[model samples]
Target chain A: MIGFETLLRWLDLAGIAVFAASGALVASRKQLDLVGFMLIAAVTGFGGGTVRDLLMGRTPVFWLRDPALLAVASAVGVLVFFTAHRIENRFRALLWADAVGLALYAVLGAEIALVGGVAPWAAVLLGVATATFGGVLRDVVCNEIPLLLRKEVYALAALAGAAAFVLLRMHGIWRDTALLAGMALCLAIRAAAIARGWSLPAYAARRD
Target chain B: MIGFETLLRWLDLAGIAVFAASGALVASRKQLDLVGFMLIAAVTGFGGGTVRDLLMGRTPVFWLRDPALLAVASAVGVLVFFTAHRIENRFRALLWADAVGLALYAVLGAEIALVGGVAPWAAVLLGVATATFGGVLRDVVCNEIPLLLRKEVYALAALAGAAAFVLLRMHGIWRDTALLAGMALCLAIRAAAIARGWSLPAYAARRD
Candidate 1:
């Protein structure tokens, strides 16, 4: 049986791989070379967690401390570079994988912040940031409008998950149960958004 | 008489203001709202230093410790919001001001990294990252290509300044002298790039 911490680490790595594949697919769409694919992939995989750690004063960053994460990201990059052309609907593939990564990272981020002794509200904010910032960075670097700023319910979904995790832990729920529930909530929201075109309304100025 | 640290702080504030202004101008061009202007400005003003501090394990981040910096950035955002349309050439104005901020930040970043006891090479890298990353963040968030990744002398100019600063300090040069010389070299290169169109060659794959 895996220790709780070990299980969490595996989830984190799975999230990283899916996010990295999405990044590499974006690089392929942009006609970038292998190095570009790897660079974008690695950043996408680690970028959110890196930002979360930095804001929370965690030094050396998670990836710098653990080389295996980078190796996985780079391997995914290479694999995607060679095979992305074969995919019929790369964008759809990216969105679904991204949704999974988003859900996992949101719960993980909130849990980490909770463990770090941040306030529950701040933890939830960090969770949402952690879940979405990598994709934001990926889109930004690729010169696309970030999905976060889009009308899509991406960040709202992350926020719901993070907030749910925080609230559950506050209510003395089991940690594992809270984590699973948080991810499920996030994934369900995101999956529905993708399938049904659910989105938050765009900002509208009040007319006098 | 002002202390050296005080002088550096003033320079840092000045750099923040210029960068913030550039960010606000971009926001104006993008037709973002007031909140968007302020958010972009604040991030642009502090993003580079924030990243540098995070990488170096500097806790709380520089801006979080100094609310004055945030206030200044916000003020600049508001100012630019009202006045940007009056400017004849906002792009040219941004370039010049950005060049100044880039030069100052390159030296300051290198100095701080050295003081923090990082290796010279790492310090140089941090310096360049610090000098240009705010603009990169600004461009990225604005949905444009970052100047750093372009076929230009931007990061190269920062690299020269940071390298010169480190080399000068290694030879026991006076801190003031080294700082000024580094800034001068960086500004000169950046100015020439803007005025004379100096640029690095774009990457080209070899033909078989």
Candidate 2:
């Protein structure tokens, strides 16, 4: 049987690939050059984890320490650049892949923060940030309004997953079980929101 | 005689206040709420430094270490919120203030990286990133294209400043002399750009 660390590592790479692919698809839609595709892909893949590590005071960041992650993200970007046009429903495909990546990153982020011995609330916040911030960077760079700042359930889903993981860890649940469960909860909420057009109430600005 | 560190600290606070005021003015233009003003102001004030420290492996970040920074930024945001509409040319005011902040931050950022023993080339890049990234964050959050990515000489000015500072230091110039010279160079370039509409050559997308 594979150890928990091995499983988590594999999932982390998978998450990075999916996120990178999403970024490349955006670049394709924008008609950016190859360099733009690769840069956006790499940044979207590792941006969240980089932000998380920085906030937690982790040195050198994850990508700087492991070149493999950059290689994987860049390769995925290239592949997506060629194939994105072939897909008829590129936006839908990107959304589903993004949801999967979101769930994976959210849980993994929480676990990393917890292991770092940060406070539970801060860990949960960091996890949500890690899962969602990469996409924010992607959209911002592409000159689009980030989905997170919209009324969408994107950040809410990540928050739920990270919060669930934190609560489970506090109750002494098995680590692997909690991880899987958190991801499942996050994905389910995101999937439902995507399917049913769910969104939080729009902010009503009050003028004094 | 005033010490160098004290001078740097006062200038740093002034830069933060100016950046924060810029953000608050943007929030005013967008008609966002008071909370939005404060949040955007604080984020714009510290975002670049936060990014620089993260890249340099500086833990806990500067604003976290000194809550006074946050207080100053927030206070500037509040002040701007109440006074922005009275200004005849708010956008022009913001531009000039941002130019001053950009020069100050670029020189300080390069100095910080060099003092931290970062390689000179990387130090130059970080300084440019430090000076311009907060404005990028501010624009992106406001759903506008960042001025840094446009054809303007914004980043180029910071680059010139940072590179000049590094070169001066390498030539054994006094620290204070190098700092002032760098800022002067950056500000002169930026003012010329603003007055004469100077910009880099536009990218021509090649069809393969």
Candidate 3:
């Protein structure tokens, strides 16, 4: 039987790969060269977890502890940058990849936060932050409005998923089962939002 | 003699206040209201130290542990936001305030890193991060280029200060004396750079 830790680690790596690919696509869109692509990919892949770990006081960040992940992210960036010309609709591609990463990250993040002794509510926030902040950092670096600041369904999905996991744990559910349920919810909501072009409400500035 | 820890804490709070003031000025320029002013000010003042602490595995975060510093930063934000119109040459004012924050943070940050058992080089990087990351986050949120990314003498001053502090400490100098020397060097370099408009070299994209 695979240990829970091993299983979660694998899923986390998958999340990182998908996020890195999406970041590379963004770099291509911005017309940045090799350096930009690698930088963005690394930031997106490790950024959310880095922020989460820092906040949780987990020393020697994941990437810094295991630099192989960074090398993997860099490889993905190079791959995407070189093959971007063959891809049609980079934004669409990024969204699809990002959705997968979000689902995986939502579960992994909440689990880590809970294990680290954070309260449920803050864990949910950390889960959402862990799922979204990488893309946010990528956007900021590329000089675009961060998706977190936009009225998007992205952060909402992560929040709902994280909450679901925490709620299940509160009800004595097994950790692995709860995580799987959370991932499903995240993926479902994100997929629906993408398909239906869903968005959260925005507050317009008053002219009066 | 005041305990070294107490003196350092006081200096750190002073740094936060000055950085917060600069952040409020930037918020005013961006036409952000009260919430934005406070948010920016808090981030600009504490962001660097928070990141440094997080990286060093100093959990609960400095501001989160002791909300008093945040209160102080918010107070500065409130004061600046209310009196922004009355201030002449806000940018000039921000520059000076930021310079003071930079010097103080340079000393405090390196000291914390050394105390935290981090390697000397990493501690220096942490010091530079502590001195500059707040401003970097402020620029990102405000949709401006980060000061660190530009060819500025700012980060360089912090780096130099941090290195000097570490070097002096390694040579068996008194901690308080080393910190003072480091702060002075950071202030003098930053002031000169500001007065002469000195900058590092920019890597412009080649126009082939």
Candidates, ranked, DockQ: 2, 1, 3
Judge candidate 3 against the unseen true structure and give its global Cα lDDT, from 0 to 1.
0.83
Q: Which residue runs of candidate 1 sit more than 4 Å off their true CA positions?
A: A1-9, A88-90, A201-208, B1-42, B45-49, B62-136, B143-208
Q: Regarding TM-score, does 2 or 3 come out ahead?
A: 2
Which regions in candidate 2 have their CA more than 4 angstroms from the true location? A1-4, A88-90, A201-208, B1-42, B62-136, B143-208
| Candidate 3 Cα deviation (angstroms), residue A56 | 7.0
From the highest TM-score down, the ranking of the candidates is 2, 3, 1
Q: In candidate 1, which residue pairs get closer than 3 Å at backbone N, Cα or C atoms, i.e. clash? A: none
DockQ of candidates 1 onward, in order?
Answer: 0.15, 0.17, 0.14
The per-residue C-alpha lDDT of model 2 at residue B69 equals 89
Q: Give Cα distance to truth, residue B190, candidate 1, Å.
A: 19
What fraction of the real A-B contacts shows up in model 2?
0.26
Error of 3 at B164 (Å): 2.5
TM-score for each model: 0.60, 0.62, 0.61
Q: Quote the positional error of residue A168 for candidate 2 in Å.
A: 2.6
Superposition error at A154 for model 1 (Å): 1.5
Q: Report every candidate's CA lDDT.
A: 0.85, 0.84, 0.83
